[model samples]
Target chain A: MYEAYWRGMGDRCSLVISGSEVMSYLGGNPGGACWFLEPELEKSIRRIHHLVGNAAAQAEDGGHVVVGTGSTQLLQAALYALCPPDQPEPTSVVCAAPYYSCYKEIAELLQSKLYKWEGDAHNFNKDGPFIEIVTSPNNPDGLIREPVVNRPNGKLIYDLAYYWPHHTPITHKADYDIMLFTFSKCTGHAGSRIGWAIVKDKEVAAKMTKFMEVTTIGVSRESQLRAAKLLGIICDDCQAFSTNTKSQNFFDDSKRLLTERWDKLHEVVKRSETFSLAKFPKDYCLFSDRFYETHPAFAWLISNNKVKDCASLLRGHKILTRSGNRFGADATYVRVSMLGREEEFNLFLERLSTIKIGICNGIAHIN
Target chain B: MYEAYWRGMGDRCSLVISGSEVMSYLGGNPGGACWFLEPELEKSIRRIHHLVGNAAAQAEDGGHVVVGTGSTQLLQAALYALCPPDQPEPTSVVCAAPYYSCYKEIAELLQSKLYKWEGDAHNFNKDGPFIEIVTSPNNPDGLIREPVVNRPNGKLIYDLAYYWPHHTPITHKADYDIMLFTFSKCTGHAGSRIGWAIVKDKEVAAKMTKFMEVTTIGVSRESQLRAAKLLGIICDDCQAFSTNTKSQNFFDDSKRLLTERWDKLHEVVKRSETFSLAKFPKDYCLFSDRFYETHPAFAWLISNNKVKDCASLLRGHKILTRSGNRFGADATYVRVSMLGREEEFNLFLERLSTIKIGICNGIAHIN
Candidate 1:
């Protein structure tokens, strides 16, 4: 989906690195909170975030940017930082229902003594200190959400992976204690495996940095330098074309592509009897300076009773999707990725439109 | 020390990447055991290892290569793979005394329930299942080591970070069940944060790959590709100059530089009364085709009883060193890095030659 956009942009975003540059283990900012984080990359992240008005990255707030291999590592780092090591019992980690599928798996992967996955936040009944992961413009459901568990001792990790203006409206600048953003969703450079956390508290940031050092010894400097270059290009384009609505900036271009895909998906869903798409209301985006509907990276599709398993039904048509059960939702729902190549997405829409409720009953047997 | 070698190589090892290349989350080998492992990088690693005669990476052995963010992550992955999740007790993970300091720190960082750090493999008397990490040409005290605990349930992870021909002689091709290597030590590309595991069992390889996916999604593609390019250059140099000793190859060039530094340090140690260096016997190196003494990246310096704290004593002289206490040894020893730039290495030798045993007692007070 984003390949064409980057290709059309030509060498303006390309990178050339010398063999001897950035070869040492320590990064440029050795004395900062994240000793291994490249200073230029940190500056680029703050500039982009401030330009987008998504998160508070100003130096006055004492926000420290801790870079990770990806947001996945950042998620684990956050859990490790928030949970007290000497606590008698493991800290309960909870997220809302229909949350990202990886939260539980990542939390329990190492079976850390400091924290344990306690399932959905709505069902969390414990009164002790807890950590709630709030994914705004959430993964499976594609809905903006806030923390469901309200407690004085509760901590929050806001995974704003999909909070960019192209995916969701620039809903007021998210002022949170900890916020995570990734280069994957923002610039469609998932292979770089670069993500950063904008943490407000100095101690928490230091602990997070320690987690990075103990885990992978810090994120890749090659990726950090490359990400800095890419983010600089994005910021440069935004500055040059801030008032030009017709110019194809990164956000505007991505939004245009996503809107077209969403429009096609809406048409397909309206005609289908076996599946229904989640509806999102129009919201004003400060970056684009207009009201727009969220054309999310994922489509939350609910299947009718005729289809016993939405994921299995889609599999019959050769369309791969994640089952809602993985996200703590009923199996009647399936999350379809809307970020595929154009031809592949067209094939998915074509296959999905042909999947009628009558055929849903015996689709598995026929396939 | 290795920086000058790489800088001398110039743009032959430099990398130019287009914006559209390697943008997808998936790698070229999506169906591989390590799905996110780049195919070219895997091929390059196998080629380099085969060329160096260090590890068994041949395709005929059905060996699988699992790439990680670095060898640090791979060590954790090896633990996760060797220790069964359903075990009644946490598997004891031990390395020999004077082991890599990070082995203990990384193992216990998460307080993992699957494995616990059981210090000093020589003292590990438990008869149950255990994971032993064997660091040949070890970090602090450079020496070849093998597992001391002989048991049927014991699993071994060979940390060959310093096994390159530049650091130690290649005695034979290692045919271990699991072997860990990193690009940081191989080419002094520490900022790349790339490492890999060669495993004989497919199940173990798959489990290690799963750990990588759950932890970091995968290592950075930019780093992986850059590593592949750098390794390719080394392999090409070896091929082009295999018969000529006069021509500069990667290993020969690095070994020459390391030999000079070691010679200077030996002269200083011979004259200093307060410090003694570790002894290493000359062994036949197949790659260099000569008998060569080990020139480890770190110097294990033992201080006399006059110095109470070796690390503190060095700190007073403006030298940063890790105390032997961190490596589970007495405080009379300190690990000094010999991999600094040429000027830094000279300054260290100059300062060490001026220090006498009489000053050790009053060093803390004078500083």
Candidate 2:
């Protein structure tokens, strides 16, 4: 859907990688030698981590960063590192209800005896070693979440994929033991397939690097270099435009556009009796030093009427959405992607506004 | 080691990826719909396979090709697909002795209950389902190999990373259920981290795609596009330089240089009584339709006498080589990479030739 949008934009989000940018297989060594990440990517990650006041900035030594093909790969790496192979029983891995579908699938599909996907984190009460995946500013619902499975043996993997300034409040320097960030949501460069993690423990960092070594050897150096270059541009722009919200940095511009789209979407949702949307309260942002509106990557839509499968209803309206069932929730809730091109979003709004819900005995029904 | 060599070559091997190369994420689709793989990459792969008469060249319908981050990930994917998770016992994965060290390490490190690293293929006589990894023009030994354990339940994975024109004679179109290839070994773009597989079975291909879906989602579009462009250049050059022995294509130039280096290394080894090297005979070529000599990526060096651990001995002489133990081989052998920069190789040769070997009673000692 966004392909046509990007094609129309003519290199708006894409980046050019120079011929000589890639010349070595070793990006950064596993032992915090800066060899696990491409040098420029490492530098950019450090700069951005500092600018965002996220986990890396809070560390005494900037923490150890592990670069991956994407946050999904990092997610897998985190799981691989935390779980030992010889666990007596498969270590239960869980995420909260309305979680990212990929987590459940990846955990189950990799299917190690050391770990098993055991559904919602809220339901798990297992005493043995377990892993809880925490997706903050959650994928579908756009809610800030904390680990609910507060067990002593439970480890938390905070996926900060959408914690960028544009998506949520800066809040604080998010220092944590393990955290993941991606260029996809932050810079809208999903095609690059680059993501990174900031780990306080060197052992965990080394283990994550080992995971990468066996999986893809390492992420693409070209993608890493391209991400580095783009991050540099964004940081430089932010510096120049720090005083003004109308400045041309990526977050400023992306947020403004998202704000308008969200308003339009809200208006459309309000007019419909069949569907409702998740509400995110304004939060105090450290970067802006003020309350900021939410700009989520997706709209978690709930059926307020007889629409049992919101996704199927949306499909009938010619506006495709991912079913809440994919996220281990009921079919009444669906996730609508908010990260597409401007035209794609506009079309989604147009189709959604025109959607006619079915009525039975004066009750609103599926569209 | 090769970093300075490439830095010295400047743009001789480097590739330029245009800004517009990665405007979309939908490469060819998993169902062979041309949605998951970049169009150019798919085309270039098809062309190269056809030109070289390699794996896909002999396919009945051009077979299914799955692109990965590198063959390492594909290696994992293949293992995931071929082995059922519910198998009562873990399937043993074996490569020949003196194999690529990463194979065993990756198999063990991933540690899925479905598969276990079972040392050398020669030692595996397991009754149940197993995977035999055959690296033709094998990693360290440069010996063409077949599955020794040809059990009905045994699966064979052909890693043809070195079967290209530069490394070895393209003997025939390799039609196999699973075959692996990489741009790193072929085009010297290790930084790209892109590799692919030609799988005859659709079910297996789908499984591989599923693995990517849960891992990185897909390879970098920029890397894929870059690989496609480079492959196009190589294939085109191969076409134009097909008949000319003095042709200046990449493979031609690379092979010419490798031939010279191999000859020089052989000369150096001839002067020493303590070392011996693997020898390859001329083979009939299907790509060029003529006999061609070998130019392996790694040199298999055996310590004939005086040095029990050849890699350790080389390290003492200030030269680095992979120990034979890493490949489940005896300590008398070592694997030396041949693709390093010109200066690095020269230095390695100088150090290796001047190394003093211990002698017993005026005779070269076996220890």
DockQ, in order, for the candidates? Answer: 0.85, 0.51
Q: What share of the true interface contacts does each candidate keep?
A: 0.85, 0.56
TM-score of candidate 2 versus the correct structure, residues matched by position: 0.92
Please tell me which predicted candidate would have the highest TM-score against the true structure. Answer: 1
Residue B121, candidate 1: how far off, in angstroms? 0.7
Q: Which TM-score values does chain B get in all models?
A: 0.96, 0.90
Which regions of candidate 2 fall more than 4 Å away from where they truly are? A1-21, A28-34, A58-61, A243-247, A358-367, B1-24, B28-34, B58-60, B243-247, B359-367
State in Å the error of residue B301, model 1: 0.4
Give the alpha carbon lDDT tens digit for every residue of A1-367 in model 1: 8888889888988878888888998987988999999998999999998899998987876788999999999999999999999998899999999889999899989888999999989999997889999999899777999899988789999999999988999978888999999999999999999999999998999999999998899889989988999888889888888766565688888989999999999899888766788789999988778998888899999875546588987898899999988998888889999999999999999999888665544563322
Off by over 4 Å in 1: A243-246, A359-367, B244-246, B359-367
Q: Chain B TM-score of model 2, please?
A: 0.90
